[model samples]
Target: MYKQFLIIIIILVTTHKSVKGQDNQHPKWNTWATWGDQNNGTYRNPVLPADYSDLDCIRVGDDYYAISSTFQYSPGIIILHSKDLVNWTIKSHAVADITQISPEMNWDRMNRYGNGIWAGAIRYHKGKFWIYFGTPDEGYFMTTAKNIEGPWEPLHKIMGEAGWDDCSPFWDDDGQGYFVGTNFKDGYKIHLFKLAADGKDIIKGTDKVIYQSKGSEANKLYKINGTYYHFFSEVKADGRTVMMERSKNIWGPYTEFKQLSHAQNDMNSPNQGGIVQTQRGDWYFLTHHGDGDWFGRIMSLIPVNWVDGWPILGKVGEDGVGTMVWEGKKPVSGTKIITPQTSDSFLGTRLNEQWEWNYQPRADKWSLRERKGWLRLYAFGSLERNDNLTKVGNILTQRSMSTKANEVIVKLDLSGMADGQKAGFTHFGHPAYSAIGVHCDGKIKRLEYNLKGQVTEGDQINQNVVWLRSVWGFDGVSQYSYSTDGKNFKDFGPAYKLMWESYRGDRLGIYSYNNKQEKGYVDVDFFNYTFAGPQKTKK
Candidate 1:
């Protein structure tokens, strides 16, 4: 009887522990993600199936934090957090406005489309979190804070010269600082320079040509076990594959580069990213597939194997290179699932971290406080002189994940609209743009879909509230939809092709603009988004 009682007690304790753990890691995108943890100690590829390109990651204690590129997007340099490498969440962003880098970055100019914050790296050093990045037209920039969730210092220009990109900072054992980056104007040469103690300035005259090749870039520096490793991506015959070199000295008589990954058949290659070590002393590489598509360069986590003082990415082959793995055991386990932020209810005063503006937004034009539980957007003329919907300022957007099937619906309240105002669900990248919105002109409101100047107008919308939607999938085709009663959505607009433009993937955007005058507004109540797993997503 005693033995039976002990066995029952053990079972109850185990069950209670599991339930509590699941509560903490609850809702890990099992329903909305196309790829991720299998929940059986393994995770699938493209760990983050989104346009989180040119990523860099670092591990602090048992927590992992990563930062990714946000070219032309305000509040640039998105940050993500995870306990285990497989499951992640949007943590915060590094900058409030990148337009401060140059006037060309302003929404009104719209000249900095393919240029803004490029590749960067994040590190925790001496009890503070540090981030360093560079733009092609601008120079290098850095920001730091004592905590990862920061009150970060404002941007401080490190290198004021242009034509440089793909930078990361490193610290020596003696506490000396260094910065490595590519000078694209100089044949994509990788340069090494000494950094100031505060990491806010480069010590002049310390520059040296560390390495250069045909298409060598994606510069990252690390010191492991008394040897310095230079990790980067270079263009090879198979496309851009991850490559690495090592030296006993920082300014090296470095070894000949070894190819770390081989290009796969379907894609350009897996290249350019950062390497991180887990609490268990195992290493992994958080990298983006170098190929760009409608969904941009989605991310994949690759295992790192240190063989003969060299780290090989992905799985090793007979050629001494590695191949991409479709799935692998997770780096850390027993952590609950935490998916990146997506849909929003507009119930809170602040926007979710997922949302970013096309450029520096006109502060006074957008508001959540005007209405208690809705996002109020005031319509204004296009920031661009022309009438392209892509140039409309303050088009709020989030990353578009590269899943097979995904759908997004927006509930917009048009009661507050004024003459000449058009507002609703939209999407735009460098190549093309489209919108499904309500246009109000002279007491008349018409539901319409506009794709690259092609107008598809629906019946007059007498109702003050409407739901506009978009459904797209792996094939990169999108169709617009809308409903007056929030059910039985009717498809509108021609079939749209999602695009990769300006170094960015297609993003889900909500826009409000007026070609006639800046004299009206729209209120958004809720945004609901759903993405399917291997199972198909349907409208």
Candidate 2:
């Protein structure tokens, strides 16, 4: 019978391409989930394999965006979006309350794990969309937004002056308004300030310090053509350097400086970031990699060369420094293969810009409309039963890509858990972490792991729907697994080892706590992230 009508037309065209690949309003383009598009248009370099550290980036017309450094998480500045600066996505988040600058980030958990919101700079100027960060314990902040995909405009401290750290903001060419920072407490010096053309205050005396070296700081201010440069990042001992300086005058003895990357061949210390250009003019240099490892400071795009007025970053040879570029070309030619912001399926209503909330979440205890599609979380426990996992406040994280192997899975429902609750799927970092749970106790549920800080106990999940998974390997090791019929999973406990605390790397949390009585809640419903071997067949 025509082979049974071509096997029912090949199972209805593979179930209509798997229901149009789950259609999350247009997702499909994982390309191994991290790293630039390698659909053969040739691209690679950290190009965003993960840990989008202190970079900056800006373009505005054909769109580019790029801002990073979320230090204590909570939403404080992430914004990505790209049309061709080598694919990117997560397009919004510029503060949604890190307790609006410390309420000890939520009633005294003080988990500013590595200090909040460090290195910043992202500008569009005049039509709005400027950013500017710093927080060696809350000092210089600033926000603005004529929309770079935001509602932004809350944080605006403008220098209460503490230790200051990598900051940048500039607008000149006659409209004059400037601010540049980095005063790691008086010696790592490199200050400049003078804004107030409505850039919001600080024209007091113009603060000047101009420049100082050795471990300089990630500064970044530019003018080009008429000079004024001043890009930075300098740890040097044969590593993180990528300095520069110039002056037709933006305040200085205005010297010349220039070091521009010598982190050479293996490209281990590329240093801070910022420097775009490409609408076919070609400039690039959006670095990171200051020797970070467990996956943290990743991002890199190098390849810039200006020479006479300085700008050199990677591959300039014959001793003018520069030399990174793992593989490139493709600055902006019909780009459209974006990637970055992995799987979720909590079926929308808000909460999947790749998630984030290790700190500022208590907003009525987390929900996505109470169980409609699932992502309820809600047990605010932990006043100390040995409160670890950094004092457990609403966990929920993401960013653990630099792939060579990955897996995330999550489907937990546990019938609104409770009796000293515990709901899980972790692999978070900071003195290490592990988890894989469901530990209720009064109606008896048990099936825990907890690992680093040991807890171990398993076999007692009479099912209410569970699925937790963790995987991850490429030497960062991680294991944990479970499944109550989400198709047989099993493994559990011990293998952990993924480290890199404070400045972060090794995330994938989604926890839910209750040291004893915050009443229960857990619902996740779906997360599913995947990535396979050989760096997904490299490019």
Candidate 3:
């Protein structure tokens, strides 16, 4: 029978080449739409350019290095590269000027928008490449290079004070080299300094006072094969537990001190963690948690097992946070997926590092390459949703591409606003800030709600030219609608739930802020986002 008709045409050509290779690897996946859509959803931290908080990892030989905690945003020290640690790629940005950071005035008010750089520390030694960090209020720095990218040499304060935050550095195999100072204050608890072999300052030994914590702060020190460890953490009291510490020697009349990790809820406060080893020796513990506060933090991986010698973390349970475990295709290798990239048919050529600008990133306001793919935004000075909206300059941010539920549709053809102009879409955090605009203030206006800390009126519309929409969700849910001719959308009412002050198991996205101060311009034309799961349904 012709072998059953050639086995039914070879099983229908292998199921049509696996559904045409998953529709070319998901082309804006949409199983259905009109709200509550689902069908072929995916994305829940498969580790795609995650928001990266205050983390710092290291793993030499097979390669793996990381850096986080940018604080004031800018292109500050963000150098990631991996290899089987579950994909990662951001080859540069170890301080791209801004006067090599160190020019603040109101950071003493605890943290002004310019909180400078926060916790970062990556080491490589001998072959060169170090990066101790601090600048809580300006001071305690170190930068080196044999190549981590750059002629990196411009910040070297080492210790100036104002609570020199998270500073970690160490080198030992007998020839010695150390530094483990994190927020020193009550008699400078853990402070061991000794380094100077062209790796930058603090070399004559004298600052040694090991373990001292009434609570805890980012601290690290390791030396496996022959025993010698001491890690630190603590900040409970309901603020989101963290407690952890261990010691053995190197200048420590040290003991045990344990509590390990807490906060299964209460909005996780995992805090700083870093440790690496695995050429086969196995041991990992890179951390950061708190991915909400309008979405901005996520990175975790814990699996510390040293039994009789101390250290036995999560072991990958109790949701003690865990994720990266590559060893297979070896993560960072030319990498690509470009992430949810927030569909913008306004063409491409730039502004897709997940777009961010809160401090220094000015290119005449905005434009994704002048008239090629269209995304021209130019309006600054009245968008005062405050966070220095007028003085520090209006903001435009990104980082929340989806952690399951999703919908970010943006399409504008403003017809041009002229007269204190105002353009739309926003949701920045810190005392919360929200938006949905399209105004002229002289004839056409709309203010579509949620501008945290102040600013209410979740909906409005009056046309001079029309086509506007906004929808943000998750936790303090939200939904605003408008349309004069973009396919029926008129529902700007009671669907609001934005309490804003988030940072508790996070993920959320989409933004656009315009305040027309001098020039005034906005021509987005296209931007669409998508994500949804529950066994999928709508496309």
Question: Which has the higher TM-score value, candidate number 1 or candidate number 3?
Answer: 1
Model 1 TM-score relative to the real fold: 0.92
lDDT of 1 by residue, 1-539 (tens): 99999999999999999986654331222122446776667777768878888889999888899999998888889999999988889989889877668877776776788888999999889999999999988899999988777778889998888999999899999999999999989899998999988778889999899888878898899999998999988776756777888888998878657888886636447787888989989999888873557788877788998877778887788888887766678898886655788999888887889999988888899999989889999988896534477677888999876676789999999988988888888778865878788989789999888787566777799889999999987777899988999998998878888888888888999988887887789999999998765322346
lDDT of 2 by residue, 472-509 (tens): 65567878778788888988877777777787777778
Error of 2 at 205 (Å): 1.4
Q: Rate the local accuracy (lDDT) of all candidates.
A: 0.83, 0.77, 0.56
TM-score, every prediction? 0.92, 0.39, 0.34
Q: Cα lDDT of model 1 overall?
A: 0.83
lDDT of 2 at 252: 66
Best by lDDT: 1
Which regions of candidate 3 fall more than 4 Å away from where they truly are? 1-49, 53-68, 73-115, 118-137, 141-158, 161-166, 169-178, 181-219, 222-226, 229-284, 287-398, 402-405, 409-418, 426-441, 445-539
